[model samples]
Target chain A: MNIPLLSLKSILSRPLSTLLSWLLMSFGVTIVVLILLVSAQLKNEISKNAQGIDLVVGAKGSPLQLILCNIFHVDFPTGNISLKEANNLSRNRYIESAIPMSLGDSYRGYRIVGTTKAYGDLYGAEIQSGQWFEEDMKAVVGANVANLLGLNLGSQFQSQHGMSEEGEEHEEQSIIVAGILAPSSTILDDLILVSIPSIWNVHEHEEEPGEHEGEIIDLPKLGIAVSQEQLEEEEITSILIKYRSPMAAVMLPRMVNEVGNFQAASPAYETARLFNIIGVGVDVVNIIGILIVVISAISVFIALLHSLKDRKYDIAIMRSMGATRRQIFVHVLMEGLLIAILGCISGLVLAHAAIGILAFYLEKLNLSWSFFVNDEVWVLTGGLIIGMLAAIIPAGLAYKTDISKTLSKA
Target chain B: MIQIAGLSHCFSDNVVISYPDWQVADGEHSLILGASGSGKTTLLHLMSGLLKPTNGSVIFDTQEINQLSPSRMDKFRGAHVGLIFQKPHLIAALTVKENIKLSTFLGKKPEHNRHIEEMLDSLGLIELAHRKVHQLSQGQAQRVAIARALINHPKFVFGDEPTASLDDESCMKVVELLKRQSDQHGATLVIATHDQRVKNHFSNKLEL
Candidate 1:
C-alpha cells in the first residue's frame, strides 16, 4: 500500500515492458563491467611481469616480438645471439646486471628457460620446496608449472625440442625437478628454470652423439663454472639488462642497436607501444559496451513513458484517494528507480559470473577476478541517473493530472 | 458540518456552473440530484476538495477547505473525506485488500489489519480480499471502492453516481451498503446521481 510497494506492483503489472528494459540494462552493464575487468587485468599482468627489466637485447628483430619472447615468454625467440657477444655487452659500464636466457625447449606447454638464479631474483621468486638447482641436469619449476604439470622434487622429465605438446622429446638427457618456486604473480610462475647448459646439453646430444662417451670430464655446478671458451662459442636467446644509471636510459638502446650485432628494446617503451596498439580495439569494444548502456537507458525511458499513458487513470485514482501531487510524482519515479537498481545489481552479478567463467578457462592468464571494483560505483550511479531522467517527464505529467477531469471522464 | 457558500466553477468563459449555498450537518445523509449537465458532479467535487472552485468557499467544520494550500487540502481530503466515483476506478495492480489499505496509507492514518479485515468482512469481500480488482464483478468492484473510502473512517463520504452502472437490485444493494457503512463509521454521506431510484433513500436532498 506504500508508494514503493505500489510502484513495484505497477511495474510488475506490465511484465513485458519491465522485462525488456531490465534485460537491456543488465546486458549493457554486463558488457561495460566485463571490459573494465579484462582491461584492468591485462594492464596489470603486462606491467607486473615486465617489472625491473630495463632493456631486452636480442638478435635483430621486431622489438615487440623480442620483448614478448624474452620478457613475457608468450612468443618465439627472435633467433639466438652469440653468448660471447651478449657477455661483452653485459660488461658495459652502464649495465648494472644482465640475465641471459636460453629458450627453445619445453615440458608439456610450459617453457623451460635456461638462466642463472638472477632471473628468479628479477621476479622475487623463491624456492617453495626442496632447493634451487645445483647441477646442470637439475631444474627449478615455477609454482604454476609445478601445479599444472604435477612436477615435484626428483620428478624426472625429458625436455621437448619446441614449445608445443607435439615437439620432439629429447629422451637422451632427462632433467629432474630440483625444487619448486613459490607463487609469484608474474610470468615467472609459468616458466621452468634450469642452467643454460641444460638446453645446450639436450641439443648437443642430438647433434654430436658419442663424441664425449666415457670421457672423464667434470660437470660444471649449475653451469656457472663453464670455461670462458665454451661459453663464448655457445648461443643464447636474449640478455635482460638493468641500467646502472639513468644515463643508460638515454644512451644504451641506441649504442647496442648501432654498435653491437643485437638490438636492445626497452621493456617499458615496447609494452606501452603494445598497449597503444591494442587500445584501439579495446576502445572500439568499450564504445560498443557504452552504447549498449545508453540504449538501455533509452529503452527504460520509452518503457516508462509508454506505460504512463495506460496508468493515467490510476494516477487520478490515487489523487482521489488523497495522494499528494508529490506522492504521485515520486511513486512514478520510484518505479523507474526500482528498475535501474535491479538492472544494475543483476548486471554486476552477471559480469562477475562471466569473469569467473573466463578465469576458469583461461587459467594461464592467472587473472585475479575480484568480486567488486571501484568503477562499478560510477556505473551504478549512472544507471540511477538514467532511470531518473527517463521517468522525470512521465512523473511530472502524473503530478499535474487533473483529478476531477480524469475521474469525471469515466 | 459541511457548508458551501457562493460555490461556482468555470470550465471556460461561457461554461461556468454556480451552486446554491447549502449545509449538511455532521452524520446527516444527503443527496445531490440532477441531470448529467446540471453540475451535480462539479458540486460533489468541490465539497470533497477534489477541484478548486473558481468562486466559492467550502467550509468543513470551522476551517475553510478551498482556502487551504494544495498539499494541505489533499491531506485534509485524505484524512477527513472519502470519494466514490461512478466507476470503481480501483488500481488494477492492487489486490482488493490493498486497494482498501491504500486509503489509510495516503491519508496518513495508522493501519489496523484487524480493521481492514473487519471492513472487508462487513462488505462480504473477505473471501476475495486477495483478488485483483479487475477480477471482481462490476458490483463487487464498487463495493471495494466503498471499502477503500470508509477505511480511514472519514467524517464525510462523497459518492458521484456510485451505482450508475449497476442494475436496480445491485444499485439498491450498493446504496444500502454505502449508507450502512457511513452510519457505522459515524460519517455524513452525500451522493450525486441522476437516477430517480436513489431519491427514495434520501429525504435530505439538494436539487439543482
Candidate 2:
C-alpha cells in the first residue's frame, strides 16, 4: 500500500484532466526555458566575440550598428574612415594596441578581412597550414571558411566586390590561400585574412578623407584618384582599439568621437544597448510564459477541486482503510507535484529541441549553442514552485474532508 | 466487542440524534434498522470512530476510539476495523486484486498476496481479480468491496446500506456472505440500512 502510488493511480484513472493539466504546465515551462536558452546563447556569442576590443572607431553612424558591423561582423560597415586620422588617435598614451581592419570583398558570403598580423594575435588565431598572409594577394582562410568553401593551401579564389555573395566578383585578382587557421570557436573562424593592400587592389574599400555617405552620388569615379598604392596607406574600414587601463574607457571614446569623422563605439556599451532592445521582446515573452503558468495553476486548482468532490467517497473508503488526513493531504499535493515534474521534463526537452533548430542556423555562422546552463536550472525551480503552489488549496480541502459525511452522502 | 454510552450528535443546532446505548459481544452480528433520517448511519459512524459524538464515548475492546487522535484512529481502524459503503468506491483504474490489497497497504503491513488470494477465492471473485473495477457488474464489484474489507482480517466490520440498491436475491446472498465470512473469521458485524428485506437476517436487531 504505497499511498503515493495509490494517489498517482487515482490521478491516472482520470486521464483527460491529468493530460490537460500536464500540457498546460509544460507550455509555461517551455516558453520560459526556450527564452533562457536563446538569450544565454546570444549572450555567450556576443561576449566571446566582443572581448579584447574596448572601442571600435568607424565611419560616423549608429554606434550599435558600428559594433554590429566591425566587432561582431553581423552588419555592413558605415562607409570608410581615413587611416591617417585613425592611426593618430591610436597613438594616444591611453591606448594599449590598435589593430586596423578593412572589410569589403568576400568569398561566398564570408568576409575577407585585410589586417596586419596583430589582428591574428588579438584573437589568438593560430595558423594550421603554410603561414599567415605574408604578402599582398596572399590569404589565410579560417577553419570554417576552409571547411565550407573547401579552400586548401595554395587554393586560389576570386573575391566578390561587397559583403554579400550576390555582389559582383573581383575576377581580376584571384587570391591564393596561403594558410588555414585552426578553429578558434569564435567569430574569427568565419573570416578570410590578407594584407591591407589586397582589399584596396581588389574592391577599393577606401574613400576620400571627408567623404562619408555622399560619395554614393559619384560611385563610378570614387576609386579613380587613390591609386592602388595610395589607397593602401589612405583608408581602412575601421580601427579596433583596446584601452591600456580602465580610466581610458571614460575618455578615449569621448575624445575620438569629438575629434574625427569616425565615431567610436564601445562593444560593451553597444552590446548592452542591443540586449536592452532585445530585453523588451524577451520581457513580453516572459510575461506570456508566466501567464501560461498562472493559467495552468488555475486549471490544476480547479481540476483538483472537482476531483476532490468526485473522490470524496473514495477518500472516505481510504480513511476507513486506515489513511490519515495528513496522508490524504499529501496524496493530493503529490498529484500536483507529479504533474509539475512531468511538465518540467517535457518542457526541457521542448526547449532543447527548439535550440537544436537554432543551432542548425548558427552553425553556418560558426557559432555554438548549448543547453543545461544556469538559466535552465532556474526554470526548473520555477516549474516546481508553480506546481506546489497550484496544489496548496486543493490539498487543504482534502485535509478537511469529513469522512463520515462523505460516506453517508455516497 | 463494542460498547456505546450516552451517545448524542448534533448538526449546527438544526437536528440532534440521541442514540440508545447498546453493547455487543465479540463475534456477534447485529442489524441497525431505521427510517430515512433516523440517525442509523450517524450511530454507526460514532461506533466506528468515523465521527466524534457531541457527548458520548465509544469503547471497542480496550481502546477508547473517540478519545484517540485522528491519525491514531486511522491506524487503529486500518488494523482492527473494516467498512463497506452503499456504493463500491474502489478505484476504477486499479484491478480487483489491487483494490483489495489497498487495505494491507494502508495498514503499512508488508503486502502478502496470499491474504488477497484467500479473500478472492472465498468470495468467488478470483476469476475477476485482474479486471479493472469498472468492468465488474454491481454484484461482482460489491463482492470485491467485501474482499477489501476482509483483507486486513479486521476484528470488526461495519456496513452502511451495503445492499439497499440490490434486488431481493442479491441482497440475501450479500447478507449471507457477510454472515458466513464474519462467522469464519470470528469477527463482529454491524450493518445499518433501511432495506426491510434485510430485517430477518439478524437475530440481534436494533430498531428505530
lDDT, candidate 1, A1-410, per-residue tens: 69999999989988998998888888888888888888888887888888889999999989999999998898898899987667667778898888889999999988999998989988898889989887788999999889989988999999998889889999898999999999998887899899887778888854653233332322222225455545556798988888999999999988899855699899899999998999899888878877777787787778888887777877887887789999999999998889888988998899888988898998887765574668889988987888788788888888999988887877
Report the CAPRI category for model 1.
high
Candidate 1 residue A84 C-alpha distance from true site, Å: 0.9
lDDT tens digits, residues B20-134, model 1?
9999998989999999989998899888888899998999999999989999988988899999988888888889988888889998998999999999999999999999888
Stretch of 10 with least lDDT, candidate 1 chain A: A214-223
Q: After TM-score superposition, what is the CA distance of residue B88 in candidate 2 from its true location, in Å? A: 1.3
Name model 1 segments beyond 4 Å from true. A206-225
Which pairs clash in model 1? none
Residue-wise C-alpha lDDT for candidate 2, range A207-294, written one tens digit per residue: 4322333222211111112343353356888888888999998888789888768799999988999999999999999899978877
Question: Stretches of candidate 2 above 4 Å error?
Answer: A204-233, A364-369
Of all native A–B interface contacts, model 1 reproduces a fraction of: 0.75
lDDT of each: 0.87, 0.83
Where is model 2 chain B poorest over a 10-residue stretch in terms of lDDT?
A: B107-116
Candidate 1's displacement at residue B146, Å, is 0.5
Q: Candidate 2's residue-wise lDDT over B1-208, tens digit each? A: 8998899998777688898888888999999999978998889899998999898889998887999988899999989898887888897768998998787888776678887898899999999989998899999899999988877878999998999878888899899999999998889999999999989878888887
Per-candidate DockQ values are 0.81, 0.78
